[model samples]
Target: MTTAIGNPYLEGNFAPVSDEVSVNDLPVTGTLPPELNGRYLRIGPSPKGSGETGMSHHWFVGQGMVHGVRLRDGHAEWYRNRFVRGDVPEDSPNTNILAHGGRLLALVEGGGAPVSITPDLNRMSTWDADGALRAGFTAHPKTDPATGEMHSLSYLIRPGTEELRYVVMDATGKATHAAELPVSGVPMVHDMAMTATRVVVLDLPVTLSMDAMGRLAAGAPESGDALPMRWNEEHPSRVGVLPRGGTADQIRWFDAPRCYVFHVLNAYDTPDGSIIMDVVRYDTVFRDVFRGPADGPPALARWTIAPDRGTVSEQIMSDYSVEWPRINQAWAGRSHRYGWFGGTGPDSLRLSDDVSRDRGGSFEPGPLVKFDTATGEASAHHFGTGRVTQEPTFVARPGAEAEDDGWILSVVYDGTADRSELVVLDAADLKAAPLARVHLPRRVPFGFHGNWIADNEIGA
Candidate 1:
């Protein structure tokens, strides 16, 4: 069964799977690494029932479903898919998943509480750090590798909410500090960046739209069932750099160039008192389509924010279009040498209106790219054609000292076979063939971020 006739997001690899099946002893094509002793879990919108269709159905509004692959003792142990059951299951966290603080968490942005799940991917309950999350948690949280504390910038999307919160969670997964930073508009804060001493807040141009809300409330045809956020040209784009646990008054604001950023690769503080950040940048989003992002083929860019001069210098790091940029978690909030991303094209950027007319792109699969930031050189591994690759999560080799000494795990969907496989590549050699491939029973739909939760990290 398919979704709305021409809704691209509801068709192809973006389509939702109806069954929640568990299959053990999956077939493996190559030798699995014995050290990969844990789970590779990914979560995304998998809408329930065929009742959801039409222009109102958006890509980001589907139910949360998690797809997991377990590896232990050099074997593909099992593969499972389960729904993140909630009071309103459709609104459950579906953007990212990770094991932190001794519990596995499914996460989302825009004022949603983290849904704690068992290590095996079953929903438990809404987690608020023993009731520390007053406003909610963000999908993207930066962990301080030096201190083991996780930090994020969270915001509630509403008609009158005019502030964003800076939250910190200790190594034990308890909410340690949270501060409400006042702002003029309720911006869509998808991700945040952190350094040794401060947290970077993105106050871009995309904001909550009351007009779209009124249209949806009145059941207008043009008002789709997506989040009501639009590109507010009047809203000034800026970045607030504040001390890790600092209050609003302590935040130093700088005017940023007009643009929107959905993901930050990494950030760190320089000796000159400037914050250096790398991010996937979009020119403008939510302008014509009320659904998901319909802007540029997002490019990797770097921003140098000088607090002393109160200015920001923006530089497009590469002309190559990409998304879901990731780095070594061990180097989080610090200088890094390598970054991995899924390649995209201009055809992938389309609006809902275009999708209805059969003009949207499927975000077709491109090469998996590895960027050498220090040398401005890149290498790629193309998985032929018609194979969609998601974000490449980097897992370092045990006791490895080099930054690129690791493996890159990504979920790739083979269109010809109508199935998916977990591809493991050597980070040091992107052009080389995959190290291993674990074949699965079904195609894991294109989705957002996830991680390699080792046994030690989860105490499993």
Candidate 2:
């Protein structure tokens, strides 16, 4: 049970770790794969102070922290955690970290800019490399596997005015193209999907709070820059499809069902000229996020957007409460059979409590789930007892041939030991025994997305 007055985000396993440490030669269980030669890195919001809870506390807003574990030639070398640096209190950028332009970046949507970080897990600086990202960058920018190009659709919501930007960056990470997209009140477009020929945008019902806007104008104490985005009944939920490297004016808008999507599983074009977009659809958000999560649990669903009809249809793909969907990057912006997400079960909370600093925390990832789109079959690697998993990142073995031929790497919190470990599971057999478990000195509090940066991708 959460403390009567304590913020749910800061009280339990969700609580933030105060110290940043570096430890080499971490303890390992099982055998570390020799082919895994890179760093398993992840980032998320960590509260700068426990006192910043209550009416102002939010899982999405906090000091951006990066946690990383290095692997090379059958050994887990080191683990380091660092807070992304910026201007000061004015610069808390916690969201997702990714590799772009051959450099690693820490990104947060809605106002905080993307900050670059060293491969050794050190914060570099706020990246305006050539000044491509004028506003804010999205946490979920789609990286094209074929050309190594990154595509992003970002929205900035402040005291007044509203709009979205379409940005394209080459493999080296210089902004090649940028365009401004006009829109009504600020709508929460957290993630975007990409196909071989187009950029898929989600324009749902979650709108920025005007009441919060008014409060900010009156100089209310600033807790977070997000400023509370709430669900709007009057707003029409929709999706926008724009041709790749095209302007927003050419976008074809399609009416979508009354729902919200925080992340997309995958999307591609159908043979019949239709587009298949899979996403984690939420019933609502920011409804009561300050008190608790808004929706029960988001589910994986598929929406078929038919442009001729100007409408989108959805089908629930899995009944499981899932989020943070991932797929092989090679299959991204294209079709694939396998998909993965974090799942929860009946005894989820009970298991979470053991590792949690306190009782009564909110939703935490329970298991790593794998899905076969071709067969509609499901597989899971559940953390049996006294453990919880974070977003699983897929890493394909060198010269991998099959779709699920690599390994699923995730940061796991072991309640019994009260420490975190990075577990590696064969993607083809997620339920099988972990290939290896690299132990961490401290816990990796529940966090957002990250990716495995291969040796070649990291600068020397």
Candidate 3:
């Protein structure tokens, strides 16, 4: 569905697939672990039809489609991809998919309510925790391993005011608590960090702009790619630390560097009352190009916030430009030793949709990187030259004792074959060859976030 003119996101692997596929017993190259019995589910933008093409087709604002692989025993059972829509397809949740509170949900941020889907990817309907969620829900919600509760901060994408809401969903999928916090502007809080006692809010400088929305409304040429947000210089970049179960007035604010963080690897509190947050940081985003986040390459950085001193420190953990960080769910909101990331170079448009200019960023295939936060060392697994990978989901082995005792699964797209495969790697040994490769039915476009849902956690 490419057009006469060009938009980078609408071409190649980023282009949306038009068909809904359900294939059983997909081909496999190696053996799937007998203990690995669940589904590796991922969702991303998959716009329908050929009407929305060209530069106006922003990558973030597309219809969501869920792609999943079901595995049982040592067999690769099936692969399915379905649009994440209920009665109305426009408000489908497309950014992330996860199982929580006995319900499986497809999620989107910036004011869209989450939509529940069945185990087989069938659309169920809009979910609001039985009407408890009055505002929008965030795509990223940090689950507390101690209590199985999920916490998130939600805000409207097209905000007219300057406020955000902090919500806590209990283990039973009920909204336990919610509070409002006043802010400078409607900052695009893409993700938040959670510690044992606090939920850290990233109040960065990127904000909603009425001017950009006006351009899209007027049907301006090249405005098809215009996102409603821009890099706001007037907005002060800071982080808000709200105590667990505390009100907005008790939040402590500390200044941060003028940058953007799309994902937080993990965050935890130190004994001395400091917060350590690992994240993929961008120097700037939504700047000159209103299309995507191509202002600069994203680097893995750590931000240490000290409320007692009202100061924050920044340090680069890995300079190898990576994103989509995942760790063992057991270490969530706690100290962790290892994390997996997808590598992207300075080239490849730097996550930007405008490929009109020849940026030095390389289009070559990237490696799946295994990062050790304790030693600042990275080991990468290359998928050859013609292949690119999305986020790597780490599934720990049953009753595993070691932190790295698990399997890393990622969807790798091969440009040479115009196809995709699920690559499996021993989490402890990235230098070794893949343990298995599950051949998918078709190519899977680079998407946002996904999780490995075990059968015991939800069901088969």
Per-prediction TM-score: 0.94, 0.93, 0.94
Model 3: CA > 4 A from native: 1-4, 49-51, 221-226, 346-365
Task: Please give the lDDT score for candidate 3.
Answer: 0.82
- Report the lDDT tens digits of candidate 3 across residue range 3-111: 3345666667877887899999988898889898889999998876544555566778778889999988888999999988755656687899999977788888888
Prediction RMSDs, each to the true structure: 3.2, 3.7, 2.9
- Candidate 2, residues 78-180, lDDT tens digits: the string is 9999988875554657888878777888888886688878788764777765777867788888989999989998887764546788899989998888877
Q: Which tens-of-lDDT digit does each residue in 65-176 have in candidate 1?
A: 8999999999998999988875454448889888778889888888887888888775467877887874678899888877778888888878889788887889999888
Model 1: residues >4 Å from true position, as ranges? Answer: 49-52, 87-91, 221-225, 346-365
- Could you give the candidate ranking by lDDT, starting with the highest? 3, 1, 2
Candidate 2 CA-lDDT value: 0.78
* Better lDDT candidate (2, 3): 3
Superposition TM-score, candidate 2 onto the true structure: 0.93
Model 1, residue 67: distance off in Å is: 0.6
